[model samples]
Target: MSKFTSILARTFLQCRPMTNVSTKNMNMLSLMKSNSNPINRLAILSISDFNKRHKSSATSSLADKELATFLQDEIENETKSMETKATSPTFEGFNTELKDAKVILTKKSGKESFKVIFNVNNSLDNNSEEEYSEQKNVSDNKSNEDVELGSPISKPTYTIELEKNGQIMAFYCSFAEEGSYEDGNQSSPDSAGYSDLYRIDEISIYQNEYTDDSYSVTCDLLDEQMYEKLFNMLEDRGLGNEFASKLAEFSTAYEHKLYVNLLSKIKNFISS
Candidate 1:
């Protein structure tokens, strides 16, 4: 055999599986080679084997590419769904001013807490015939004039105060609630109950850090411009009237209670 033929045979023998079928094929090919030109025969065999292996590798690469594309699409869809869920607002409660309002708070070591405020609007229709009839009857009765109408109205306003170890340090009005509508119930014209309404104009948070004998406190409330923008938006969207006022009153009371509790906790922590 030629030197080139000898080298090709050795290379093929090392690479092919050592099986009876491969051995038979090798023997047959060797017998067909011309004694003087065995190099050509070996070249043909090498070419055929290379073509088969190249085709198999090409098919495997195509399948891998398809699988990768499918996986990529699934990952992208899941990421979009997670983002939507994170941004979507969830209703916190109902029948109160703070109801359906979203609250987000974040705090880090040595950093002040960050708060995001969400606007909440509630509406109720009172133009029904039944409601009109009731109001007409009350207006006609002189005895009902002195009786309280609707609900009590508290100032939809709040102040932020800093307390350390059970002592007040500073106080300031930071948030004020605005009424959407005046109470329309028939009652004494001068009675305060006729002015009851729920409104939550703004929310403010008081943050404090206490040491052994001293504390640092800060108050952050909604910006005036932002609050005005929100108020305008609600009005434009027809979120006015007595129902909105009542909601504001309830929310103010609830928020006040929450502030008190938070202050109490801080006092206890410092004392301990």
Candidate 2:
């Protein structure tokens, strides 16, 4: 008989009724396997079925573990990217009012830079008349300065904070100076009509695991149009030969450092 038929015959014999009837036993005996006794064949078939079921379950468990690990790694990478993006400075869509303008020259790089702060006092003045009048003189002076310069100085100042591998290393401000027109001749200290100039201050670079060294870098003012053009070029394709050329035009070490830091952050984000 075929192996399938043999296994089936053995199962029927082993499961037959316990009652002893000579004629029934004779009839059942006719279904026995050709080579093996009924009991032995039945035992082999039961063991084989059990092994097949066990193997199928083990394979399923292994596949589940592999899938779980893959999902976990994907989640971790996504979380890191989100956190980095949250902390990093974005050039676009920034809005803040600039105030308290000052100029400084860095000795290390021999570059002149401007720094400014946000006009938070104005918001408070808007709510309180007394506060508004008290601060009016300061505001008037700033307005006069703007008017004398013949350009609206309403742009917001932004502070750039730098970090390496999730630790803040330095902070600096981008500022603008009002140009002066002396005796009908435009005689601004920075001959460039650009109101926006960035200055680097308060730098802290890590010297070791437990200590940090601080230094200040100077700023070199760039023409507003040239600055914008360079910014656009970098935005299109960041920090390559073309961008480097534009950066070279900036004579100040502080300016170079700011541009490099910004470029590095942008490149890392894009590649990620």
TM-score each candidate. Answer: 0.22, 0.21
Q: Worst lDDT window (10 residues) for model 2?
A: 101-110
Which ten residues in a row are the worst by lDDT in model 1? 106-115
lDDT of each: 0.40, 0.38
Pick by TM-score: which candidate is best?
1
Error of 1 at 223 (Å): 55
Q: Write the per-residue lDDT of candidate 1 for residues 104-222, one digit (tens) a residue.
A: 22222232222222232221123333455675568669674763233212232332222334443222211222333433211112335333132333332233532455533322244
Structure candidate 2, residue pairs in collision: 96-156, 112-219
Q: How many residue pairs clash in each candidate?
A: 9, 2
Query: How high is the lDDT of residue 82 in model 1?
Result: 36
Point out where model 2 deviates above 4 Å.
1-119, 122-158, 167-171, 180-213, 218-272
Candidate 2 versus truth, CA RMSD in Å, comes to 23.2
